[model samples]
Target chain A: MDENPATAPLPANGPLDGDPGLQPERTALAWGRTLLTLIAASAMSLRWLPDQGPFVLAMFGLTIAAGSGIYLTQRRRYRRSVEGIRAGRLAPDAAAVFWTAGACVALGAVGVWLVLS
Target chain B: MTVPSTSTPPPGSVPRRSRFAEKILPGGTEPDPRFTLANERTFLAWIRTSLALLAGGIAVEAFTTDVFPEPVRRGLSVLLLLLGMLLSAGSAIRWLRVESSLRSNRPLPLPLIGPLLAAGCAVAAAVVIAVVVLG
Candidate 1:
């Protein structure tokens, strides 16, 4: 039986032997889409806040800016990873764990508050 | 114990180390895919949590009457929104870090934000409770 390209391993230092453009682009798009969603959600929250309009707007703006920065950074990171794989020198990122754990704790706190309050 | 000898390779004949496995698990070894997938899932869960926080902030600001002053409401909303954004952004960053770490065969990074977040939440919760009790 022929092996599935999606599951089959490509030789190191070759073109990304599977979906290639489609898969990487899809992953990148997923990141972009999530960022945009979070940005829109933040805007909605900002809009709802009363009186401190300018402050809220500023915070939202900052959040959007941060999101954009993160998005661009992820793009670069992924691109580098892809290139590394093609070049047979893939390197793992070091900061990803802290960021994920931090976000989890923050969100968990929010969840706790929402449930208790 | 009985010894039997067969020279045939296993049926599914995966190479000693495949390229995809190497990318997924660098260092010329295979780690569990489940771990990687779980990490990704956790990150997504955090993003969802961020969204929920944003929703809660909006709800608080939009609903509720003079039970809380407008300024307080706005403050809470901004806090929640900011938290959401931070959490989402942080989660993505962490995911990347973890993924890379797994590839490079390093110990997972220690979690520093957890304590800070917990303290912040405790303070925020206490304030909310005080408002509820005093108002």
Candidate 2:
């Protein structure tokens, strides 16, 4: 049987479905805080790169990429979260957490290297 | 694709989507998704702490390059940077543990790394205090 497929409601729970929770927005804001913290740290470390060359520049690039990644993903995350909330199935975002945490470790390693050499 | 309606549903079998996330949080769906968000925020907070320590290391090295004995100054900076690395790496483990526990309906695990990080920061501070006092 052939059926028309254009009339289904979008997969979203109504605004009141979850009782006024702002968890997705708060999670995004928490990421914003993490991004700000990382940017500040990158700026702080930039002082030492006056003569240290490309290794340091790479650190700057790392943090910038991390910032831009989180920035770009924010809208997508927020939108997908609405659908997830509506459907009651929000999975943990372990890879995003892993990457952000990896950036921190890389930045810390760069910091240590800058101090030592 | 319809999932079987067991009381405990298995995680999706699509490992190709994310190898990194495949086992990070095991033990079925979280009972409440809000707690998962809280866990993510806490992980972010730990990362912020890591960044703060990294900045502190840079600040000490940049500002005090010659004010103290070279070894002492470099040592403090190194210590802070090391602490930052530990915090950064540990945050993910902490997040996974909490998420797993939340999913399994268990009490949260004891904060095995949090107090150690605090103590490490204290030691770094005491070193600076010792330097300022002795000279």
Candidate 3:
């Protein structure tokens, strides 16, 4: 409690419990893995560029944008999670889960179109 | 029933969170942060599974152009893609249900997605194997 809330530095290894390296770290890494999988799916869409022309590029763009949104906010999320844990009020982020689902649906639609057309 | 708290809060009070959050957050007593975090990880795992399915669909379509007949390949690819879409959407619902259950101290819901995914993948594999054996 002595450390100023605003000025307290983030943990070097990432925000984790005093017990050291557990739940929060695992969750953070899960997000990271999800981001990587999304990027891989996005890149795979590029293989359709020649076959589907520019339409497939849109899928790539949308998928990458979604991935970027998650990537950029990761640090903020980690910080909030640590603070929420300490305060005993971890707010569940339904929007993040929903938007990720939406992005996957979009990607799947695009893939189906590419395959069928 | 109690009246909503409409009176203005004192200065420096934490503002109310979004309506979306209010709906989900107000119902359950606060669960352990670690449990909440674990739930988040499970949701992320499902997302990854969806992405993996999408990647498989793309790879099948992109690389198997000559291996399987056009109609057969397209059918398999579309099947996988649709499953990917289904899983991604379902996982979000699953996450919410689990969170709510945790809050209310109910037993966690059975993951209906598991059987659906297994069946979908099995069908896709069977189609591939049939094509390989027949043609």
Candidate 4:
């Protein structure tokens, strides 16, 4: 077992080999940008909702809730990635992708129905 | 040549020189900076997609009313709002998955959203056509 943390075997080939810190920083920044975008979009949705006040409010509420989840999840993800790199064991994350894709499809379907009906 | 770890390599590692090297090349060593950048770019692309969906929802809710019935307009507004929420949620989830894969050094997970998105778009289009043709 490599005693040196710096030279410790990586769990997987992550982005930063030379400087382990750099990749994590980039990933964090990416998440930050994503968070900002979602927040802005949510604000727009809240403001633009029409005469159907309750429905619009409900949707906006959900957006805010989801945004909070994203913010928290991103932070946790950064920490976990860092840990995985340090420990030398790669953890799998397929569930997140599946959830995201499913959500997108559902949203698209709902949007289209709204537009046409 | 024994290179000092203190100094960074110029860029991407030298191309894989052997079959075993190729297998390890993709997952054996820490990912390259370029890979990180590429992953981030992919994430941003997904975010853009989500934003577009959000914008689309808002646009449909606001503009379609000019030509649609009152019930239809209201329905569209609700639907668009729901869509926006869905996009935001989806993008966040996707980001998490990508980040995890990058850290683990495993093969990037296959995207499952493509079919769902395509199907959703198809359904939406059909509904729009029906509305236009029936009206």
Candidate 5:
């Protein structure tokens, strides 16, 4: 009962009570930039439509889907980050990062195949 | 307000860590949020680099139809696309390694991307130069 209220923990549901670094906001923006890049790549894939046929179209669709997924989840991630900081705990999004990496590798391999054939 | 807090936590209180976090990054005290965010940004930057490289590959294939011979064109395109693939995979692995290191309080691992990308780009340049000179 003698604990200093000033040094006590903030309420769990309190508004973003810590992290002045704006790290979460910056991270969210970084993800947004990544989504933008993916969309640009999708658009670029369309340039190969006439020659590469439907394969490039499929790639474009996939890229768009991935981009959309990122856009949709960004808000949740941002909120979680804010809460995480306040709670003094945060988990990295490993699955998303790995999946994105996997998609890039697949796209690269497909690109190689398309060019060779 | 977004004031930075270096405030000491009350004794006997445990930070609320998630089970998933424990599974992925099992130990060590949580590092500063700033560092984690920075690491995430670095990973995203690498992903962008991969996409840019893939775009370059596709551009070469799509636009260089008449400028270079078929064999050279295909080879160069393949090289670039492969580089993109390598970098994407490398970046993902690097992110995990770094995150784990951060969690464990170990020194971060050295990135092999700089050397690898440099060598690959040099080779690509050499190939292009040879084609331009000989063709």
Candidate 6:
């Protein structure tokens, strides 16, 4: 909640009372946690990585790339979020969200295949 | 998968009413940012579950399956992995749906996948038990 009595028009400012558009910050943190989980899962799955030659290795590379992309974009996302917050028109980060989910789906598919084998 | 961050609505930019935005967002108005953030958190929560399921699936095969008969073990692992895949995809779709609702000032959509997940797991558990008992 915004403790700033000086700020005008509370409801217009953000969703919650007194919150000065903290959505971006919160979303960025969520992104951080998501990326961390992905990386941890990826690392944990390493031991389980199938030795099916190049295909499995490719999976490993793709997973790492997803992690890297998330990592590299962290700051940029936060920056854009802040900008959006101030602009009073936050554009959605549909791409990043979808990408992260897609990566997990791919990993899950691979995991399923691994199990079936 | 990336939402194009290219649209910069200038402060107090004329509220442009378009069929596209109207179709995506529910209330016909831009939602408070907090709701958007909440939607994002929900999406991440789903993704976390997916990741957990994926890890669990692999761990089942890699570590826990030694005692299980080959087919039983493989079946369980596959089930978990499939669940993960479903969760991951479902979460993404739900995220988009909620975001649109928030944009339109519509009531947030309750997740449809929760019950499906519960039922899916129950069915899988039933299979697991039957495989062990009947085999």
Best by DockQ: 5
For all predicted structures, in order, the TM-scores are 0.47, 0.85, 0.86, 0.49, 0.84, 0.76
Fnat values, candidates in order: 0.06, 0.60, 0.60, 0.10, 0.62, 0.48
2 versus 3: better lDDT goes to: 3
Comparison by DockQ, 2 against 6, better one:
2
lDDT of model number 4? 0.53
Docking class for model 2 is acceptable
Q: How well is candidate 2 docked (DockQ)?
A: 0.43
lDDT of 5 by residue, B1-135 (tens): 465344544543433545665676777766665677778899999999988888888888888888999888888888889998999999988987888888778999999986888898899999999999999
Write model 1 residue lDDT over B31-122, tens digit each, in one string: 33334444555565666666766666666665655567766776676676566656666766666666667656788876544554566567
Interface RMSD (C-alpha) of each candidate? 11.5, 6.3, 8.1, 9.4, 4.2, 8.6
Candidate 6's docking class is acceptable
Q: Write candidate 4's Cα lDDT for B69-88 as tens digits.
A: 76765654555455455655
The TM-score of candidate 1 is: 0.47
Q: Give a tens-digit lDDT track for model 3, residues B32-101.
A: 6567788889999998998899999989888887898988888888899999999999999899899889
Residue pairs with colliding backbones in model 2 are: none
- Evaluate model 1 with DockQ and give the value: 0.07
lDDT of 6 at A99: 83
Q: What is residue A116's positional error in candidate 2, in angstroms?
A: 1.0
Q: Candidate 2: where are CA atoms >4 Å away?
A: A1-17, B1-19
Chain A TM-score from candidate 1: 0.54
Restricted to chain B, the TM-score per model reads 0.70, 0.82, 0.85, 0.67, 0.84, 0.73
Model 3's i-RMS, to one decimal, reads 8.1
Tens digits of per-residue lDDT for model 4 on A12-71? 754433344455567667656655665555455454456446755765566566557667
lDDT over C-alpha atoms for residue A48 of model 6:
57
**Model 4 stretches with alpha carbons more than 4 Å out:** A1-21, B1-44, B63-135
